[model samples]
Structure formats: C-alpha cells, structure tokens
Target: MLENTLAATYTPGVNLKHNVAGANWTFLLPRFALDTIVCYGVPGQKALKTLARISNNLVIVAAEASTQTMPPGVRLHSGPATSLPLPARTVDLIYIATRDAQRLIERDGDACDELARVLKADGFIYTEAGVSAGWLSQQSARLGQAVRYWLTPLLGEAQTAVPEVDAATRRYFVENDLFSSSVRLAAIGFGKRRQPAAEAAGDAANAPLRTGGRSGKRRLRQKLRPLAAALQQAAGRVEGQVHLLGKPLARRGVLIGPEVGPGIPQYLANIAAEAGVDLRGWRWGLAARGEYSSRKVLIFLFPPDEQRPSLIVKMVREAGFNARLENEYRALRWLVENGIGDAATLPQPVFSGYHGGLMLVGETIIDGTPFRAADGVETGELAERGLNWLVELATTTANTGVASAETVAAGLEVLLERYIEIYEPGAGERAFLAEQVDAIRRSRQPFPLVFQHGDPGVWNVIVTPDRRTAFLDWEAAEIHGMPLWDLFYYWRSVAIDVSRRQGVQDALAGFERQFLHESPLNATLSLAIRRVCDATGLSAALVRPLFYLCWMHRALKQATLLPRNQLAQSHYHNLLAFCIEHQDAPALAKLLLAGRAEPQVSG
Candidate 1:
C-alpha cells in the first residue's frame, strides 16, 4: 500500500488498479475453469485486466451502459444485478461488491436467487465488502504485537507523533508486506467471504453485508490502507513513526530493512550533496529489503518538491549480496562512459564507497512512470523501445565476432546442471531439460553476443508519457550474453506477472498465446525479435532455443538467491519446469520445431 511513497516516486502506474477484490482473485481465479464471468457492478480495473487476460467472455453488468466503463476485450451489458443479461447457470464466476448486493436486495433482503440462477454449482461468488475507516481505527488498537514497534534506536529507528493523516493502521500492511504482488502467497485477510451460489441462496450470514450500502461509513481497507507504520497508542490519535537522518520523520513508516547506522544516512546524503544534489528536507524511504542473510537494501531519497526520487542509495546487507551492488555500480559507470546511458535511459552513478565492509552505491534516480502490463499495444511499444536499446548496446559493446557455439553450450550446460541440482527434477523433467540444452548444442548456430539487461521485468522499467523508457536494477546485467535475452526476458517477465495470480498452468496458457499463437501483440513481439536477429546476423531458428535458454539463465540467478526448498517456489523454477513438461505440446512444438534451418554447432 505504498500509495503515498509510490505517488511521491511518480511510478504507481498500475499498482493502484489492484484492490481488495483483486487480492481475492489470487485464490478466486485459480479455482475455476473460467469462460463466462459477469462482473456485477463496477470492480476495479485490475479485475477486468485479469479477466480479459484469462478469458474472453468477461461481461461487465450494470444498471445502464452509460454508467459502466469497458476495457479492451470485455463486453458491457445494461441491466440490473437482479436480472443478469446472461442465461441461467451460464457464468462460471460472479463478482459483486457487498454494497451492490444490498442495492439489489428486495424486501426479502436476499438477491442471491438471480445470482445463483446464473452461476454454476461449483462456481464461487467472491464478495468483498469493507468496514468503515472508523472500523480500521477501532481494529488498530486490537492489532497484535507484531510491531515491537521499534528496533534499536542506534539503527536510526524512531517513534514519532502521528502526522495529520489517519494512517497509523498502515504499519499493519508494512509488517505484513501487503504490497507484495507475488501470486503463490497464501495469506488471507480479515472479513473476506467465499461462498457457493447454491449455498449462499438462503444464507442470512451475508445479511450483515447488506446493512451498509456504502452509507459513508464503509470503505475498502485497500483504499484506506495508507503507507504508514505504528499507530499512536495512548493519546488515541493515530500516528506512525520512522527516522530520517536520525531525527523523527513524522507519519512515514519504516520501509524494508533497517538502516545500518546513523552515519550511513549521512554518508548517503553527503554523496548526493557532493554530486550537487540538495535533499535537505527530502524523505528517505527503504524501497526494498532482500533475504535475511543477504540483506541487500535499496533506499529512495525522495525530494521534498519533486515527483521522482533525487537519489537512490543501495547498501550491501551481507557478503552474499556484495558483488551485485558492485556490479551495478560498474555497469552504470560503463554505460555513462560509453555514451549508451540515454539509449536505455539508465541511471547516472554519483558515488561509490564502502562503509563497515558493506558497499553502498548512490545514483541519480531515473525519472519516469513505472511500466504497466496487460495492454498489448503499450507493451508492444515498450518491447520495441527495450529491444532497440539492446541493439544499440550490442553494437556498441559486442566484439562483432561469431559467438562460439561451444562457449554458448558450456554456459547453457552450467545453467542446466545448476537447475538439476537445485530443483532436482524428475526423470522426464531432467530429460526434457537435457533435450533443451542439446537443441542449443545441435544448432550449429553462431549467435551474436549482446550486453544483456539481465532482469528487464516491467517493474524495473519506468517510462515518460512520451514513451522514453528508463531501465532500473542492473545488478543482473551481463557484459556478453546471448542475443535476444533481454527481449525474450522482457516479454516473459510481463506475462509471468500478468498470469501469476492464476498459477503455473495459467502462465503456460499465456505463454502459448504469446509465443506460439498468432496473437495481436505477437506481431509486435515478432517484429522486435526480427530486429534483434537482423541487427546481429542471428537466425529465426535460434529464437525458440534462445527463448528456452533465457529461463535457464534466470534459474541460475534465482538459485543463488533463494534457498534450496524455496527455489521451487520461485516463479522461474515453475515456468522452466512447466515449459519442459509441455515440450512437445502441439502449439509450442509446431512453433519451435518448424522450419528447422540449422545454425551449426561448434562441435
């Protein structure tokens, strides 16, 4: 719920689209083989985006066409909730807000018969109605002692008085990490309802929801969940606290990871100062905190008057996280020196130094809005921009010699071996993985070596309204990697996030649609792929192989970060496994194996 912090950063592009109902979709969507879904009343844009992506027959029902808004693929039906446009027992899912439920209620105060008439027996009507803002305040006092409230003051933590905003309850989201968009997480929130249409027909248990038709007393917790930490206990005035420059910075909650020392913040401020940046009154927020042992942390120094962060400070949490920060520092310096910074819109490095054996690198924040997924046209444009930048970087940094097939195979094999070791796949899984590696080897292909933006996930990207894109988080970049890694990675990353809430199979279906099927965006993606191959003398035959190999590279990277048992939980592991399982699945096989023009193996 870092809405405030994200707003301050100017990058809350699509994150705001998600709401309490959208959160419910994580568990809700995966349960059904959805074809027809009636979004009763107006749900958030996130639900529509998700519904549109998963299935085509998403009909938004409302009182009138004038009252409802329709996104790209969905239809709009003018009707009351009591009488849906669809036939009986047709819709696999019915999503309605509790207020809408109350509005549809007759003197009987029950509206589920019409809803039940249209929904399948096994289908779930996922209804989420929120309590009042006052309810949140009342519950804040009842909050568990999750916040010891403060760590040591020496670590730059402080408890301050509440700011003017009523968001002391926000710390609950922070401690809970409600900002996470990960799909597999099983955490359920308070007052969420999941009932069958048949079962809910006569239920009065849901009547309490009908009592408040949003009479100004009710609000979704998601909408009111501000970005703050720790409510004020004694004065009954809700307040949150965190320290900025060792003094109490009112209202702002502690973000990810603890500040190492009082001197570190000063040191970061000093770097910005030396770089001619004046952040006297700027608020410093911890944007990311990595694994426990490898606590690499990212701190954003938000300028008081500006939308974009003035400076971003990244510090090493431990020895395991050291090299990447150092690599990112070097990568930024190299790009700036080589004049490739603007092509990709990379950050400008300000200063680098070691404090207490942990490395901290300060860089000027890239100014733009974060990229939003689910729209093919915009994503297509983003793909073109990202791929075009990759081409320029390759031309600048590449040796321009044919990449040795043996060298490529060796690196691919190392990734394969690591995957086997970490994931310990079944025999079929292992054989499919080996066959994938062998395909890369058999292709006597000599692909161009490109400077890869290792993890070009959409979240790492932020764009100006004009579409001038800036890429962030360069810790995973490679000096000389296989061509099209960034392009493929960008598309896969976006699809994974889009299909994530639906689970592994949903991701596979999305992949098939994107890579194999003749999708609207596929042409855009295909053209971008062709541009890379055209620029580097690479073949289309290598496209399928390279696409498969990109996941291997990601698998290796994730293995280094996540522990053994948790590696399977990683998105990359699941995607890689699912791809192998469907190796010969009709569409993918036809796409990958057709027109088998060979690029010769070095062996």
Candidate 2:
C-alpha cells in the first residue's frame, strides 16, 4: 500500500517540493498548503533541469558552493544557509540540496534558525539527497564513497518503498543535524553496505605489490612504550586497586584499575563529603561495558531513581570533577597559559601523551552527566571521543532544529578561539599558514604526519542521550610537525561530511585559525624549535632531523599504508619534501611526478 502510494502519485516529474507525496497540495498554488520550498546547491543548469521536470512553483534557493568548475547552468548566490539572505515568516517549506552541510548547519543550526526566520507558523519541509550509499558503492574502490552523495541514493530508494519515508528519513536528517531540512536523497536500490572489491584479479595486479622498509621501529616503539607503562603500573608505581568485578550487567566482569577504581570511590566520597552525608552504603550497579578503546568491563550505575545532588554544591562538585575530566586540556592549557604552546614555552619537557578507555556515567540531565577523568583513556581515545561527541551533539542539535554544520562549526570555533587566545599566532607565520589551506582537503593531511584521528570524521564523535559532547579514541592522536596539521585533516573530514549532504564547500572558512591555535605543535613552532635546537646546540641528535624525518616517515607510511592512489600518495610525498628536502624546485617537482597515476584500472 505504501509502495502504491508512491508509485501512483509521486511520479518522476511530479512537484512534491512543498506538498507531501500523497497529498493534493500542489506546490504550484501560491496560497496552497505548500507555500514555500528552499533548494540549495542549485546552479542555472540544475535548476533548469529540475524545474523542467516538476510543475511546482518552487523558488530555487542557492547556498554556497565551490562554483569554480560549475557547469554553465549553476550560478552563484549572495547568501549562505547558515546566515541566509532571506526574510522572516515568508515560506512554508525549505529544501537544501547543497554540499557543505557543516558550514550551513553551523551557520544556522540545521537551518532551524533559518526556518524559524523564514517559514510560516505551521510550515513543513521535504528533502531528497543528490547521492546516497548505494551510488557510492558503485564507484571506484580506492576513491571510496564520497560522503556528499551517499545520502542521496538512500533517500531515492526509500521514497520507492514508503511514500511516507519522509518522516523516517527526515527524522534521521534532523538527528544527524544535516544542513537542509528539505532535501533530495539518492539511493542505490536495496544494496548491502559493501567493503572494497579487489582490483581486476589477474596478471596486471601482480606488479609485485611494493612494501616500505619498516615501521618495525615505530611499531616497536608503540609496543614498547605501552608495555613500559603497563609494566610500571603493574609494579605499583601507579596507585589503585584491581578486582575482576564481574560484568556490570553481563558475564564480563570489570577489572577495576587504579585509574577508574580510586576515582569512583573518591567521586562518590566527594559527593558524600560535600553533602555532609555518608555514601558508604549507597548502592549502585556496574554495566558490563567497555569504552571505545578497550575490552574491559566498566562500573556503570544509575543514581537512585530519585537521588539527585544538592544544587549549590552541585556546580562546584561538577566543576571540580569536570576539571579533572578536562585534564588533557588543563595540562595543555597550562603550557599555553604560560605561553608554552608558543615558541617561548618550548624545551619545557614537551609531554606527548593521551588518555583512553573512557568509562562514562551519564543520565538524561545536562548537569548530572558523568565522565571518566582518571581511568587510563589514552589521548587518542580522548581526541576521538571528543571529536565524535561534538559531531553527534551537532547532529542532535540539527535534529532539534537547533544544530547545523555552522552551529557545530561555531561550537568548534568557540573552542578554537579559546585555544588561539591561549597561544596567539605570530603575524608572519599566520600568513604563511593561511596559504597552505586548500579549497578542498580531506581531514587526512597531505603532510602525512601521524594519522592521529584528529577529526575522527563524524561517526567517531559522540553525543550523550542528553545534548553533551564527548570524544572517543584519544589514543589515536599523535604529534605532527606541520602547523594546522589537524586543519587539513579536519577539513578533509568536513569535505567528506558535506559531500554526503548536498555538495562540497569549505568547512574551514572561519574555523582554520582555531585549529592553528589548538595544535600544541605547528609548523611555526616546529620551525622555531628547530632553530632553537640548532642555536642551543641541543645534543639530542633526533631533535632537528627528527622534525623533517617525521614528515618523511609519515609520507612513506601514507604511500605504503593507504590504498594505492597516486594523488593521495603523491600529495603526502610532496608535503613531506616541502618540510624535509632542501633540494631545488625541480627536484620537488620531480617527486610530485614520481608517482603519477598510470590509470591501471577502469570502472
């Protein structure tokens, strides 16, 4: 029946812009049920093409896009969805079919702000993606599914199954905090999410798959360092108790370590201590849960269904606990506060560490939410969780009609601005850093410094049931030589994220400076440190050469570890040389051309 509803009325050429698919509210009627529709990423060609098919009186609303190589039909517009150039209370429907979801969403919280500004009192929106997961699965292996078009195909097919799929899809659209409320989604027709297929399996593929020398040393270090830390913890250099407490909610029992155990009892005691009451008999339960990092059980408990902390001390207690949870930033901020992340703060035992295995306790309330501050969640896990939390929070905000890429970006901007003020940039270096930004970049840096899950893409970022942000996988983070190293990484991720929405546009427009500030180590600082190392005659042989060598190491790793894509590998190689090589321009150019793609496979 649902299929029939779609097949009978929602024909290819039908104008469902402002009208619900099975409804008689034709979008063409000026004062009809459908009063307005907003469509983004529309150039003259796309507009004409879409307009030619539908009989709706839909006004084509163009959001920002690259527009550089846009076809003759796509035209530029003066307004962005985040900060629309439209009037208030004028429309009934808004459709955004553009890329740069993050920016649009960030600017105006999933167009909620815009919708509030422009739509009539009871307006509704409809959206269809331009691309989807199904379409992406049909593309090349190495290229992977670009995020931009992936959502489109999914919606297109869903439209075929449930004429009312709009509600479900729209729910997701809102939940993920997509930029446009109304959209066209492309679908791949009931296809399973697939892994990369092997390249043409034959003689040509036998070109002696080359392998790089050895991460043997790096791998050794990765193993050895963790081993040493674990060894030290075992020896009681660290203080805590370890009990194989059976799984909180299942068979898996928790291995309470000093990191989590000491803190829990202390946290409880502190809560009790502040309340001037005894919690020695307070009862709670542990859920057999592990964090994003490890496979250990967690001590999870729900407060007595009605138990609540007193309000006055609540703020101070939470502040202290949260301050502990935010220790990484605290430690890093200490350096920056002392103007340490800056050049002057260097040689102060630059500590490179992370926290992971986040064991968090949360409830539906904003303030009562709990996070693991002491348990050994490495930095990678922290960064991963932090980024993921932000993404999910942004997505949630988008769904509530309050989040968008721009909103998410704004939140990030707040954090970035905070970080920058802590470590203000040098004038000369700021200009140089500005030049390195690309109109299109994957969060994966071309410079190939460690693949520190800087942006962690969107999925890794998490949002609590209530609107709170937390990153997972802090251990996945790493130090890099380039300034704004995370910039390209975060940008690339935004590119993928936006491309998934409508089409791609810049995510770093107003966000780059924040990253430059947040990075404890950037190119300017690396250069300054290198000079310091040179001038101070630091005996550590690895100091100066290690900077350049690290880039080479990252470039080589990208070449060998990433799928055999010429552009990706070549970009890293060029970036590596830019930081390391002291050769003439011609040599650099030669390296760029060294891995020129040979077009070995055809789709």
Top-lDDT structure, candidate number = 1
Q: List runs of model 2 lying over 4 Å from the truth.
A: 1-456, 460-472, 477-481, 503-603
TM-score against truth, every candidate: 0.53, 0.22
Cα misplacement distance, residue 348 of candidate 1 (Å) = 1.0
lDDT over C-alpha atoms for residue 16 of model 1: 13
Candidate 2 CA-lDDT value: 0.28
| Displacement of the residue 177 alpha carbon in candidate 2, Å | 17
lDDT of model 2 at position 209: 19
lDDT (Cα atoms) of all candidates against the true structure: 0.50, 0.28
Query: For candidate 2, which ten residues in a row score worst on lDDT?
Result: 198-207
Model 2 TM-score on a 0 to 1 scale? 0.22
